[model samples]
Target: MTRILVTGGAGYIGSIATHMLLEAGYEVSVLDDLSTGHKDAIDTRARFVEGSILDSDALTAALSNCSAVMHFAGKSLVGESVEKPDLYMQVNVEGSTKLLDAMKVAGIKDIVFSSSAATYGQPGDAPISEQSPTKPTNPYGVTKLKVDELLASRAVTDGIAAVSLRYFNVAGALQTSDGWLAERHNPETHLIPNIFKATPSAPLQVFGTDWPTPDNTCIRDYVHVLDLIDGHISALSIMKPGTYQVLNLGSGSGYSVREVIDTASRVAGRVMPSVDVARRAGDPAVLVASIEKAKKVLNWSPKRDLNQIMQDVVSSGA
Candidate 1:
């Protein structure tokens, strides 16, 4: 079996991808700091190395005998990034460069980088493609865009095969024979989980209703976590050397804040509460993905819809 190193493999998406990669017959080694990740979420079938990407000695030790790396390690809170831009650059940008330098010494040439759709900033159009302008507004998005550029440039000069999967809002969990992996970000910022946390009578704060969208609220695309994992495995199995690809993973459709809350209400069989609030700075009106390239390149398409996404999350009790 091909040995692969998965950074942040104890976190939400990384954990699921590690599980799937193990089941698919690869020898998986996970590198996580447990700073924001959970050890309980990691699969026992794979080897685990507890360390942050900043530790070069630990990274080199973990990279030994590995054929490829799936990088998902970084600080990633938009509001927090705004509060600490220096931290975002240091961790996301500087740490990634450290990983790349380590990979060079290790002679590992294959990688699948975790990027975010937030890199597109406040886009002028809906259904953004790979060619969309990458003017990230916040520190978090700026850092991810920097890593994408770093990986692309490395692929060109180093004969490395790397692909960056720019993800939209990721939701839901997967149930398997061993167990289920759920979204569990501390100080939870995800919409679905936060909605579940709200009481029926208490109002959930709906930020920004004065946008130019049809519902006058911000709109975004959400894809199931499992669907996003499928995209990773698809790219891992097919990418060739000396090539680079950037693809968007999302449901072709979008849901506004109002639409999401309404759907959550119907799905939970309760009236979800809401209080319209002021527009958040740098908040885009709509941010959906044009997954045509994803379908063509990864031979993948999202199978779950919003209702199923909410149902799965609720069922998982995440």
Candidate 2:
């Protein structure tokens, strides 16, 4: 069986990928510092290297006997990224370069990166294609775009085979023998989970009430975590040496903030209370992905919808 290195394998999406890869008969080695990921979330079937991607020795150890990498490790919170731009650069951009260097030394040429739709900041109403202009409004998006650029460059100069899956908002959970692998961020910022967490005293704060969207709230494309991972697996099969591709992973449709709140309320059989607030800095009014390229190239499309996402999250108790 081929061994694959999964960086940040203890986190929500990475953990699910690790589990699914194992189920698909791949030997996996997981590298994570447990900074944002959880040690318990790392699948016991895989070799676990508890260290950050920034550590060269850790990268070398994790890459051992691995034929390819599924790079999911990085600082991802947009608001936090705004506060600590330097941290985002050091970890996301610089750490990715280090991973590439380790890959070169280890003779592993294939990688599937966890990029974001944030790269196309404020690309309005229409679904964004891979060919869309990249104008990232936040440092988190900037770092992801930088890593994509690096991968493209490496593909040209170093014969690397890479596919960057530029994801929109990833939500929902995956079931496992141990339990549900779900979102467990310390300061939960995602919509679905936070919707469940909202109570009478601490209702979820709706970020912006006055965007130009139909609902007058920020609109975003959300893909279930399972569908997102499927895209990653499909990407692994289509990687061509000395070539790079960027594919957007999202539902073709979008949901406004209020729509999500209402959906959650309906799904949970209660009123999900929320209050309107001022717009966040660096927030795009709308971000929806055009998955046409992914559908044509990888032969993949999301099988789940926003309602299913909300239902799964509610059922998982995440």
Candidate 3:
């Protein structure tokens, strides 16, 4: 069996990816620091190493028998990134460089990095492609884009094949109730989960309602977390040495915040209360992905809609 190391495999996306990889018959080892990741989210079927990407010795141990890596570790909150830019840079970029150095030492050649659509910042157009300018409005996106560039450079110099899966707003939960993967972030900021958490008294806040979108609210592409994991697996299966690719993993269709609120209310069979607030700094009015590159390169497309995503979230008991 091919063994692969998944950094942050104890986090929401990483844990899901690890479980799916194990199901697909790959030997799996998880490396995580438990900073933002939950220990219980890890699958018992795989080897688990409690470590961070910044720790060389621990990373080496985790990568011992691994042939490849799927990195999902990092601080991901855009608002937090803006508040703590130094922390974001230190962890996301500096720690990633350490991981790369360790990979070079371990002789691992392929990696599928969990990147974000935030790298595109506020695109002037809808349905951003891989070619879109990466003007990240926040530190988190800047760090991710830095890694993407680092990987590209290293691919040529170090023979490391890398694929960056630039994801849009990731929501929902595990497709199956395996009980090994779920979103459990402290102070949850995702739209759907927050919508579920909203009650008659404490309504969810909609940031930016005077955008150029149809509903005068910011529009975004929300791909199911499951579909994003599938893209990771697909990228891992076909990676070649000395190559680099960036694919946007998102639903091609765009939905406004108002639409999302309405849909969530419908899906949950209740009135999901929400209030419109002023636009957030560095927030794009409309940020959708053109999944044409993902379709062509990875032979992948998102299989779940917003309704299906909400249903999956509820089914997972999340």
The number of the candidate with the highest lDDT is: 2
Q: Assess candidate 3 and give its lDDT.
A: 0.88
lDDT (Cα, tens digit) per residue for candidate 1, span 192-271? 88888887576788998888888888888999988898899899876788888899999989999899989888988887
What ranking of all candidate models by lDDT puts the best one first? 2, 1, 3
Between candidates 1 and 3, which one is better according to TM-score?
A: 3
- Cα RMSD of all models vs. native, in order, equals 1.4, 1.2, 1.3
**What tens digits encode model 2's per-residue C-alpha lDDT throughout 1-318?**
899999999998999999999988999999999999998998899999999899999999999999999999999998999899999999999999999999999999999999998888877547899888999988999999999999999999999999999998999888898988899998888888898998889888988888888879988899999999888888889989999999999988889999999998998889998888888876778888899999999999899998999888988885
In order, what lDDT does every prediction score?
0.89, 0.92, 0.88
Error of 1 at 268 (Å): 1.7
Candidate 1: what lDDT?
A: 0.89
Residue 308, candidate 1: Cα error in Å is 1.3
Report lDDT (Cα) of residue 251, candidate 2: 89
Per-residue lDDT for 181 in model 3?
Answer: 61
Residue 130's lDDT in candidate 2:
88
